[model samples]
Target: MFDVGSGVSANWLRVVIALVCGGILVDIARHGVGPLPFGFAVTLAVACVFIPASPAPLLLICVAAAALTATVDSPFAPGVLVLLPLVHLLHLSCAIAALLPRRARIALAALRGPLRRAAVTQAVVWLMVLVGALVPVGRTPMILELAGLLSIAGIAVVVIVLDRAR
Candidate 1:
């Protein structure tokens, strides 16, 4: 997984680009050429190319943003500015998680080996994501958004820490 600090700094420009392009496409689709659904489609199209290959933390962040955008009233919904920070936070988280190797390695010299540690780490990551999603921070949409982002961040952090341990 990537480092929390490095992920944020490394992906700063990319995030900004995503925000600008996503927002513009959304706006144009929502109010001008097509509509919200159109904007969402465009956003998804762009993300398809970028998200999958990105670091895990970034992927989660992009997914969260897409999910949020998908459900909220429309593309860049009037009141969804709150999503900006939430997306930023999520991006940071995903970047961190992606730094881990595809195959895990054990850290302790006496441990069973790499395979076992990797499986354990993967399971732990899934559990963390589940817990993060289920835990409610507040009732507002913004609060919910933040909680989701934080949950993703937690998962990313776990991956980074685990990878570091190896």
Candidate 2:
């Protein structure tokens, strides 16, 4: 009785992403950068199953999750930083899975371009973070911190330009 067309609308996809992101934030609040609770993880899994019905929500959710995780967790936790891209991929996979038609046929071929772009974006972001980490900003003076803020602003501008060029 489940109709994929009805469930896979853009609005529904947004709702699903919002729910999943909320669940992730809750888990982070409860456990910090530690392991998520089984129940919450299961809930997220269920939410992901419906992601393909509206693919745009995945971007919003990923951005939100990355922002939240970066702000709430210690920057020294490289493991957590690395996991962000992996988590985004998992979400992407779940969204793609939701695209299966009523006949259970998956149009995965259509996703090749999008997936490639996403991978490239993730790689660039990870590379930037890695490079930034290599800089010895430890115990820097207030002036250095201010300069760092300016550098971050410059990076943001570059990202925006690159995104527009794409």
Candidate 3:
């Protein structure tokens, strides 16, 4: 195992990056031009912190905390909104960064160990469930489907490239 001290520091960095990026994007979206829903900020934050680490239950706790604060009209919501896009961007970036030829970093995470693999599976399932429950099916446009398909294809291609690299 890696050194405990180093690991904590690394996790702290991840959390800090997520908070800063998430806050900036959410703020800009809310005040600069196109305003996103408050929940988007929460989603972005969770995605930023958890996406790279297998999305544990603790991440869900953080999400829940954010949601609760929003429902109660927490003052931090405004600042948090600015960073929303950054958080999401970071999450996507992490997934993409691991792209080595064909296999995506996510695929590598899946192949790493049982715990890591299970976390990915669970995170995917949880994401689907959360999206289905929170976002109305009718709200998403046809473009969403296209985006989803493209994402899957991209990941698959990455995996293929990784396999070839090996």
* Candidate 3: segments with Cα more than 4 A from true spot: 1-8, 29-36, 53-166
Better of 2 and 3 by lDDT: 2
**Residue 89, candidate 1: C-alpha displacement in angstroms:** 2.3
How does candidate 3 fare on TM-score? 0.26
Per-candidate TM equals 0.23, 0.46, 0.26
Instruction: Put down candidate 3 lDDT per residue, 1-166, tens digits, no spaces.
Output: 2223312223444555465545544454444332344455456555655554445223533543454445535333544433333444454434433232222123333334744654675568557655755665466788877998999999999999999999
- lDDT string for model 1 (69-163, tens) is 55566433642444454444334333432443333332333224643655576667557656766666576588778987999999999999999
Query: What is candidate 2's lDDT per residue for 55-153, written digit by digit as tens?
Result: 434544554455556555566464456446656765765565555443453233556787898889898988888887877766778897899899999
Q: Count the backbone clashes (under 3 Å) in each candidate.
A: 12, 1, 21
Q: Which ten residues in a row have the lowest lDDT in candidate 2?
A: 4-13
- List the candidates ranked by TM-score, beginning with the highest: 2, 3, 1
Cα deviation at 21, candidate 3, in Å, is 3.2
- Report the Cα RMSD per candidate: 15.6, 9.3, 14.7
